[model samples]
Target chain A: MKVKQISVFLENKSGRLATVTRVLGDNGINIRALSIADTADFGILRLIVNDPDKAWQILKNNEFTVSETEIIAVQVPDKPGGLASILETLEKSKINIEYMYAFVGKSGENAVVVFRVEEIDRAITFLQENGIRLLTGKEVYTF
Target chain B: MWNREMETIPRPQLEKIQAERLRKTVERVYNNVPFYRRKLDAANIKPEDIQTVKDLERLPFTTKQDLRDNYPFGLFAVPREEVVRVHASSGTTGKMTVVGYTRNDIGTWSEVMARTLGCGNVTEKDIIQVAYGYGLFTGGLGAHYGAERVGAMVVPISGGNTKRQLQVMVDFNVTALACTPSYALYFTETAAEEGIDIRSLPLRVGFFGAEPWSHNMRKEIEEKMNIKAIDIYGLSEIIGPGVSSECLEQDGLHVWEDHFMVEIIDPNTGQVVPYGEKGELVFTCISKEALPLIRYRTRDISILYPDVCRCGRTHKRMNRVMGRTDDMLIIRGVNVFPSQIESVLLEIGETEPHYQLIVDREGNLDDLEIWVEVSEKIFSDEIKKMEELENKIKKEILSILGISARIKLVEPKTIARSEGKAKRVIDRRDVYTK
Candidate 1:
């Protein structure tokens, strides 16, 4: 139920984000989802790629500061209350959400929401016990 | 003038005094300082061979490294008991370039400073505010004693505390301000930010030194502060910030010929250059008691104006220092060397020695930013890890350079590599200073 996410440190200079994308694209690594945490001086480009290990090796070889982190992807109903219902359940269980981003599934009627939480195992257990469908690493990587 | 008899002494009389004092200083150092004696002996020159100031060329030139080799008190001529004071500057290596002062040396420093303040028209009635840092740096006490020597009421404010500096400048009716040129401009900006019009203050004269500044900067300070800014020159290896100063003429700094024997030498060849020609400014301290430097190479680039000044002072004047022959950067009046930064980076063993220093001036203040290449291990992609490394590097730089910097962790191989001498410092302040 855990997916691997890679984050790259970037100085807040023009063309840096473009460079990161080009590096990943040149290596045939497709980014499935991404987010950026930024400040006036610098930014962190977090990416979920189809091949995280290969992407990590390529970026590291290119002298990019890259690290791997474990994140969870939960499939929620494509309806309006999908994300809100899962958030309400997690909030009830007192599992804090550090950060989250979502993408619509390619063929399924459900949407995949990636989440970073305080406790990985506890969050996975709570979501599974609550009848929430969790996407595995391979499923999320291809989807 | 503070001392009319000496300040305006005729050229013939000045040379006679310089020659006489030069002989005595060489003898004192050759007898008292083992380092000087060994250097002279290695060069096959005896103290008796140096009969006049012109004979100083025969002596070995002392470098800042020599001072560090004799760390703490190795180069001091007088015994520890007679040494009354000590001042030091951070060396490129871990050691410090230290200088000691006897009671009489301190008195001589005060006397030269008195003449410095006098050049700024600071008299007994003037309320002088000394903002140069005190302590181990020669700037603070050097200016302080000079103000006291002339019977001026001194506001020993040292440095920093911008709000208090402005308040006291107004409340005490400060007439003369003594500090580094950068600090003076920084004060102006801070005062403007505080909505305090510093130009309207009672300040009339400014003595700026301890760093190389340009004529344009002088004009800016004078215009902004509504005061006359005089340039004062000195180094810790020499006697702090009172080695020389500008008179009302503002043409060049008048080296106290009675105390110091000035020489302009070609930095590349170590040969003496003609008067009025640009070269490295060198000095031989004739009056210092504890530390008698012999033909000490200052590494500061400038020319000596032996011609008479319009102010009628016959002491030889040196043109404002244009730049340095070495890779020393003066940021906020503190000397920073790239080697110093490289050593710190190497010692930390976190980042590669590949780094670039970007120095620019913002708001009339010098801003330094160092770009260090992040190795794969240190750049864990975690913001917290990178931030901790950045903080560690910043702290080390601050502790060593005595000036804060903005540290940017760059991707490896981002900094350009030069084919020859690696380009380390990219100083952008020269345009503004010029």
Candidate 2:
């Protein structure tokens, strides 16, 4: 299953991140999971939001460099080795993960981890063949 | 002096020579180049009307746009077969402003460049390292030919490779260095970092040009390297790097009036300013055969000094360039236009057209930072994709402009939006000459 993610380009200036969050918050768009990849000069803020299309629009209207990307959300057992187990499975299949971030689901027994892998279809098929549960876009948005 | 008789020719005789050469150049261009013929015809001026050097103002001024409109080989008076070499500088767009030289034209360049080196007393016994970039830019091969003509051992090291340059300087006993003034200073610092005392080396003189520098920069370089720093000036359109050069006196750059007729004109009005006034420097190639540009506006702002220098050269000297009429930035000796950067961004189709070029001097070298606004079409969640886009932009700019620049992907609306004209350049470097 493919999940929608929003990414914003942020310069390493004061209050840039705050402005991005404030723009989304004022528009009533909820950010579900977020992670920042930063360098000395600039940063890339990857976000999973409740309403990605609305969030992307509001961010674009606010003059933010935002993009919508399709990432996969996987449900893992709520334990210390949950991420390690899924990573081991992907590593065994030789699937490369570009980046990943995690968040605990509402059930409190499972965790949701967003993964951006190189080959989406192949990874999706391989993970399904290995009996891994993949959450669809709607499931992640409501969670 | 390489040619002492020509260098110190009397004013009246030199004017006579210039008038004769100018007349011949006008006749040749009129008969050979359709562009010049049409321009002269449109102005209702004939070649015979330009009988004296004073009549030069009657001719139409050729701008860089004219050269671009002609493109490659469009303005050459000689046929393509007779032209021995062609060098190009970056135009305002993607195309290059190409210049051609015949065999005799090359000889003229060599002779003038020899005189340029001779200004600093470069002789046959010296070992010279021509450190300017070689191909296309006209600095390296220009100084190379001159050093060879002076009967000196010419080490065509070109540019970059600081460690090897120092090794060759120390091993080969380099007596003279030819490069941009900034690079000469950079080399001095690099030499010290490597524990190579460049001052103790046999490096006696430096010929620096291609970009403008200050007298204070000269003093700093002279002190750092223990060498006599000389300022040489030229452009690709008008026979590079030997148009004018400062002799040992270092008072002002003595324009070689025998080959090039120099004039200071009000850039806005196209009228000649009185001598010793600040205006755009224009040149008429009096003796060139291939591309004899007549009254070509150089856009460099400077004053002309008509007094005889202490070096006894009778050619009128021009003060160091104070500024430019155009927004062309000379970054690391390469001509970079803001429009060129805009064209690059437009071609890439990834970033917004709004951008700013930040030019600053880091240490002794020029650093160019391009801040381009990231558009929605190019932004991605992956950092690797963004980095690839940055590299692509950097590579495209390098291929087009011939200079490396740091491509900074700034957020949209980060670059200030002006009301009328978007201010595209932020030059933080100190204005030392002014």
- Please identify model 2 stretches exceeding 4 Å from their true place: A79-98, A117-138, B431-434
Clashes by residue pair, model 2:
none
lDDT of 1 at B239: 90
Best by TM-score: 2
What is every candidate's C-alpha DockQ against the true complex, given to 2 decimals?
0.37, 0.74
Best by lDDT: 2
**What fraction of the native alpha-carbon contacts across the interface, defined at 8 angstroms, is recovered by model 1?**
0.45
Model 1, C-alpha of B83: deviation from truth (Å): 1.2
Instruction: Write candidate 1's Cα lDDT for B1-434 as tens digits.
Output: 99989998988888888888888888899899999999989999888898876787877899998898888898899999999999988788657788999999999999999999999878999999999998999899999999999999999999999899999998899999998898899888888888988788889999998887878889889999999999999998889888999999999999997988899999999999999788999899999899989888998998899888898888989988888899888888888899888888877775557788999889888899998876655655445656777898899888887889999887666788778444798998883247
How much does candidate 2 score in TM-score? 0.92
What is the CAPRI rating of model 2's predicted complex? medium
